[model samples]
Target: MNPRHTALALAVVLLVAAVAPATAAAPVDEDAVGDLTVTTAPATASAAAAAEAATASDATDSLVAESDVAVFRLNASGVPAEADDDGTLLGDELTLTLRQTASSVGVNETAKTLDASADTEGVAVRTTESAVYVAVDIATTAFQQANGTGTADAGDSFTATATVTDAVTDGENVTRTANFGVVEPSVNFVGGVDEATAGGTVEFTAATLLAPGTSLTIALAPGEGESRTTTATVGTDGRATGELSVDGFDAGEEYTVRATAEGTDLNATVTGTIQAAATETPASTPTATETAEPTGTSTSGPGFGVVAALLALLGAAAVAGRRA
Candidate 1:
């Protein structure tokens, strides 16, 4: 071979030797050559936070719509209403309170007073020269955020009231003179019996006063194992008595009696408890009772005893006189 060809051939042989062994290494054990991978994950959960914040370059911009902010309600107090003597029962039952709150769309777009008063104002009534009172010290209020804005918290609501007055009195039209408020009354219920042949009469004691001329309806429910309801009328002194129909009671089992009034905002329904005494046995029939007859006697003094001797002597003197 020519000299130049020889040198070129040697260079080719050295290059082949350098790369041949590595190429023939049988495709390297792919299982032994592990892939380099990096992964990261959180072990402990992060603390619950009011406002979560994160500073990531690229963040997922997706939204999953759940129920829009939610709201819950609670009424710890009672409703207020006002009505007139025209057979009107004016008042409210829905309390103005909120237990939970959630986000809303746009401004608080409420139309009617009831809608606006979902958690604000409560039901109210107006009367011509009449006022209504509502008592609710048992209600609670809570704060809620609307889209993190409008807050709902407790306010001074102890003196809530409603009023009604004459719209036109003496030819003078009045605007609005009615007001309402909250009030509490001491409630009392008492009753025993009016005339109890079975157990006698039923008596009731009531404390909370209704408006003058307000008829208080009290119910006398037969105690356990009783069959009938005996009703009574409340009197001026908050007392009521009426005849009771004794039925369905065990002879020896005393009846459990109770007097209950309806519930009102002023106070919970008043109630009184009593027991029907066991059946009382009547006294034994009296025998024919005869009044004793008075004895007859002379009314003369000790002279009555001497009268017999004097009579005998008189008779002897009479005989002597006749003989002479």
Candidate 2:
């Protein structure tokens, strides 16, 4: 071979080695290299799209939680106070109470009544209690209006009424009357009853308690050999008056008085006794305590020693927490 041609081929071989490695390493765009393939978007834009999808999912969950809570409240309002039971009848006040509570800690519904169960939703319920009181006015004049009642006689029929309603704001009354009925009492009087013989008037009395105009049957029982009965109405204290001849009684006979009353709104019976006056016992009353007992240094019961030890230990914790 000729020396010049051999030298030239050697130079071309070295040049090809260097240029081939450089061209292979160079970056190539797929979209530029192919007519149909496309290059992808930037990494930052793809990440933002993924984050937006997650945010939308969280927003849907938040909207479902705020709409489905149940609630209720007390029906009654302010009212005036009244007295307790006494001989005289009066209007009484009524009170209504309310308790609002959740059926479960979470996944339950809120409502007025607890009997109806709540559904299992991812929800929390809150509860509260409130109360209201209303005033009512009851009078004897109300009784006259209920029954077409004029003058009442023995064994007559009548009716009484009862009602429940809201408290009155103005001078007017508002009541939801539930019921009213009339009734009579049962009372009987017998034995020695001196009408005008003694320093004071002596009258036989029998009694019962209940609503007025209510029917009543009385059964009387006089002591030992005395038995007498009468038909009459009982007063508010459940008392009916009758008279028996005291003049003709044997010198030392036992006597008794009894009465019974029956009515729709009232029913009760009462009795009294007639006896010879006897010696009375002196009355004794309880004395008031002047000195109160000391409460210090008490050391009794099973847990007293344990409580003392606990109190001693608690002082250190309190001091440490306060200082810190």
Candidate 3:
């Protein structure tokens, strides 16, 4: 009951407080998944009309007559870690599915099932470090439903949605949708210099509907042989200009030049004629020759001999008449 005993009891209480288990922090929410992004590749078509429609559409077109494929990517950097000591994340239990929505044009697949329990058709999933990608192939019938039975035309559009759900949590899902349409790119010859001379600078300008900053290739196909190619970048105004060297191109020949957008399926072409350079013909030098006048008299005229003989005969005749 003395001061020394009281100091010893206080030290024991402080030691116990320092060693006691710290209260656990709250568990991270399982629904805190990352963003879902949808990207598309160049679409393929079974028929010529489908390909043409795909080229005309600016929006991503995975739609084809037989099947169209859609790609979905998930970024998990924003996701939180689980509360357990293993240090795992909630993305491990995530599932993705892509479904086609009703449109004026019909499409094939209504929905793609990507859950663990189901082996749905035409759906594949690949996972990487904190990221997952889901791909689905939709049939042409799906798009045809909205676009009608015949060949698809320009301005036709199809809609699709991608959904991500957490398998372990109830009512936890995220979705993103995109609309695609048919877009046709146009190209025309903007006219180069009135005359493209041989070994001179030639420039070609074309207008397109593709987005700005897109890379494009301009191919110049002469009447014969392999074609020549030049590169041009699209301007903010949706126009691209490329320069061509007329060194190898034949002068006075017409060539068909095409400008194709690099990333998208759009191209424009024009016909142009290469002008022949003007050539000057040299003047001929005049040659000088001595032209002599007639040197002798003409023999056909009366000669001195003929005149003397005539005079002699006249004298004789006169003398004879005197004698008689």
Best by lDDT: 3
Q: What clash count goes with each model?
A: 33, 31, 19
> What does candidate 1's lDDT look like per residue over 279-319, in tens digits?
67899865555554433455255686488778889999999
Candidate 3: minimum summed lDDT over ten consecutive residues — where? Answer: 48-57
The lDDT values for all models are: 0.30, 0.30, 0.50
CA RMSD per model (angstroms): 34.0, 41.0, 21.3
Cα lDDT for residue 57, model 2? 13
Off by over 4 Å in 2: 1-202, 205-208, 215-222, 235-239, 262-324
Candidate 2 weakest lDDT stretch, 10 residues: 59-68
Please give the TM-score that candidate 2 achieves against the real structure: 0.22
Error of 1 at 169 (Å): 16
TM-score of each: 0.28, 0.22, 0.42
